[model samples]
Target: MVIFKPKRRVCKGKEVRFEITELDPFIWLQVNSESHVSYSIDGFIIDSQKKINGIFNKYEYELGTTLDVLFETLTQTFSQEIYACASFASILNTEYRIFIWPKDFPENFNIQDKLIISIKPVIKDKSIDLSSYKLVNMSALESGIKKLRGYSFSNVKSLLSANSNVECFLANNTGNPWPGDLDALIYLKSENKTIALIEFKTHNKNTPISDEYIGKYGKQDWRRFEVLYNLQNQLELAQNHKPKIFYVVWGTKDFDNHKMIKIDIISNNKVESTNYLDRPAFGESSMELFNLLLKLC
Candidate 1:
C-alpha cells in the first residue's frame, strides 16, 4: 500500500485549495503589493497621497483549480487591510478583459458638486484627511446627507471597482465623471470614447430664488428646469449622459413641504432624476444613506 499527501504553497495553508492568478503582466499593479505600502480600509483604497484611485490585482488559474480550491486558498495567509492597486480583491480573477477606471474618486462631496481629483496608483502607510466632507440635509433628507457626506473618494470608487471583473484590463463601463467646465462632470474613464455632462448648483445666499420655486408653492421649480435645459445644451450632454441638475439649496429653509412636493413631481417626470439635501435641525428627519455615501465619498 502507498500513502500520499498534497503539498501546501507559500502564504497558503496545507490544502493547496484555491488557486490565484499570476500577477506578472500588469506591471503597474505590482507596486501596490510591495512590502513598504501600509494601509487601512476607508470605504475603499486610499493611496499614500490620501487619494482614492481604483485598482485591482488578478491571478489566472490553470485547469485543475476549482472554486472550492480558490475558496480554501483564500482562507489562509493574511493581510486584512492595506492601500493597493485595486478594490475588494482576493483570489478572484476574471478570464476576460476589464476597463481602466479614472484615478481620483471623490470623497464626501456630492456627485453633483464642483469637486474633482485625478489620482494615480499610489500606496503608503499613512491615512487621509477628510474634515470637509460635508452634506447638510435641510429638509427630510438627513439620511441622504449623511450617506453623501460619509463617502470619501476612496470608498465611492472602491464600491464600483470591486464589483467589476479584473482579468481583461478594461476601464470602468459606468465610469465616474469629473465636474465639467460649467459646474461638474463625472467623466467616463475608459480608452473607449464617450461624452460627459454634469451640472452643479452652488446655492449662495445672494443668488435670487428661481421662479420654479416661487411659481409652485413659492419654491422655484420652473426656474430649475430652465437651468437644467441650458446646462444640458451648453455641455452637449447627450440624453444618455442622464444630465443631472442638483439644487444645493443651501442656507435657511428656501423650500417648504408643498414646494418640495411640486419639485418632486417635476423631477419624477424628467428622464434624469433629481434629489434634495436638507438639514435635520430644520426638517427633523433622519439622514438617508447620506452617512454611507459620505463613508464611501
Candidate 2:
C-alpha cells in the first residue's frame, strides 16, 4: 500500500480526507475529501515508489534533473543483499528514494518526515500444503532442474547467472530446458547461440562408493574423470561453437592434489576447512549448484 504524508496541511478549504486522482500515465495528485473537509497528511508517507513517482512527477518537478541514492542491505543465505544499481529523484530540493529495508525493521516505523521508503515484494498467502515442500533424495542437478521446472528459460538463465536460487525464477510460458542423464542444459544469451552442457558431481563425506572399487580416490574419482574426459572430447567436436561443456564438482577432498593421485587414501587432517580459494576444479560448497554453472561462463 502507498501512503503520502505532507509536513503540514496543504489544502486551503475545510477538507478532512484526500483521495488520489490520476491525470495521466505520469501525473497524479490528491484532492479534497468528498465531504469537502481539509485533509491532514501528518502521520504517514506513501509506501510505494511507483505511486509516489507518478504523483510527484519527478521529471516535471525536477525539470530534467535526477538524484541517486545508494545503500547496502544485510546479507541473506539464499538471496541477494546488495543493490548495485539504484537511483533517486529530487523532490522539492530534497532527495526522494525508495528501497526495500531489511525485514528486521520495527513494525511501528512510520515515514512521517522521511524521504525514503522501501518497495518490497508483496507477500502472498500460500495455498499449497506444507508437507508438499518436504525434501527428498535428489542430486544437485536434479534439484536445480526441479526448482526451474515452471520458470521461463530466460528467467532461469538470469537467475543462474546471478547465482540466485532457481526457486525464485519467475514463472512463464517460455520453453524450459530439460535435464539430461548427465547434466542440465543452459542456453547462452549471446549472439553465438551456444548451448552449455554441464555435468554436476559431488564428493562429500556422504557420497557412497562400491566395495569392489579399490584405490586412493576409488569410484568417485573414476566417475568424475570419466565425465571430465567425455566433456573434453565434446569440446573438440563442437561445431561453430554450438555446444560447450562444463564440470561443476564440489567436495572436501581435492582431485588434482598429489595425495589423491598417489595411493594415500587416508587424511591426517581431521579438521575440515570451510573456506575455499578461487579454483576451477572445486566449488565453495555443495549448496551452490547454480553458482557453479555461472562459473562456467
Candidate 3:
C-alpha cells in the first residue's frame, strides 16, 4: 500500500491535513484527525478491483451515476451503517479514482463547513497531483438532496423534466416562466403507479410557521402551490396515474428532523395546504425518508 500526505492548510486559522491511501480496489482518502479536534474517519474497503474499474470507466464523467454507484456499493458492503453524507469522486489516474467524504468536520473550521480538494492525475507516472484545496459550505437544501441519492428510487426525475422539449416542468408556460422548479419529481412503482412532487426548504429552528412561509396559492404572487397543482393535473392526465404533491422543510441546524406539508388542489383554481400528519417529524435518515415516501405511495 502506498500512502501520500497532502499539504496542510489553515482552516479558520488552524492547520488541517488529509491523507490519501492507495488500496487495492478503492482509494482511502480521509482527514488527518490529529490536526483537527472532534474529527473521526470511517473506513470501508472495496474488494474487487475489476468491479471498481468497470464502474469507474462506465460512469467516469457522470457525477450523478458515479454517486449513485458509490451509494449502492457502500450500502451493499456495510449493512450496519448509513452513508447519508456529501461525497464526490475524483479520477486519480487512468486506472484509479478516489471517493472522499468530510464526515463531521468542525462547523467553524470552514466557511461552508465543507472541504474541496482538486487533483491532477499523471497517468504515465500513476501519481496524484493536488492542485488546490479549500473549504466551503453546503446548503441545507443541497445536502438534503445529496442524501437522497443514497436511496434507489425508480424512474427518478429532478427539477429538469425527462423530455428535453418540455424544459424544466410540464406546467411551465413559454410566455411566462415558472417561478421555481420542483426539488424532485419521482415515479413510485406501486399498485397505483403514483407520482410525487417534492419541494425542499431550509429554515431556522426559531422561524415560525406562517402563511407567508406556507405560501397560499391563488393569492397574490405565491403561485408555487398553484403551479404544483397544475403540474399534478398535467402529470395525472398524461400518465393516467395518481399525483401526490408535498413539500419538506427542514431546520438548518437540525436537519435530521423535518416537517412534511401536503398540498391538495381543491378545485381548478384553488390550492390548499395540510399537515402530513402520518409522519409529522420525518427524515431521521435518508433511508427513513425513502421508506416514508414508499409508504405514502
lDDT per residue for candidate 1 within 178-213, as digits (tens), equals 211222222222211112222222232333333233
Clashes of each: 76, 12, 2
Flag the better candidate by TM-score, 1 or 3: 3
Worst 10 contiguous positions by lDDT, candidate 3: 51-60
Off by over 4 Å in 3: 1-180, 190-194, 209-212, 216-221, 254-285
TM-score of each: 0.21, 0.21, 0.32
* TM-score of model number 1: 0.21
RMSD of each: 23.1, 25.1, 18.3
lDDT of 2 by residue, 197-237 (tens): 44333333434222112234555544443432333343334
What's the residue-level lDDT of 99 in candidate 1? 17
Scored by TM-score, the top model is 3
Candidate 2, residue 283: lDDT: 17
* lDDT score, candidate 2, position 49: 30
lDDT of 2 at 102: 17
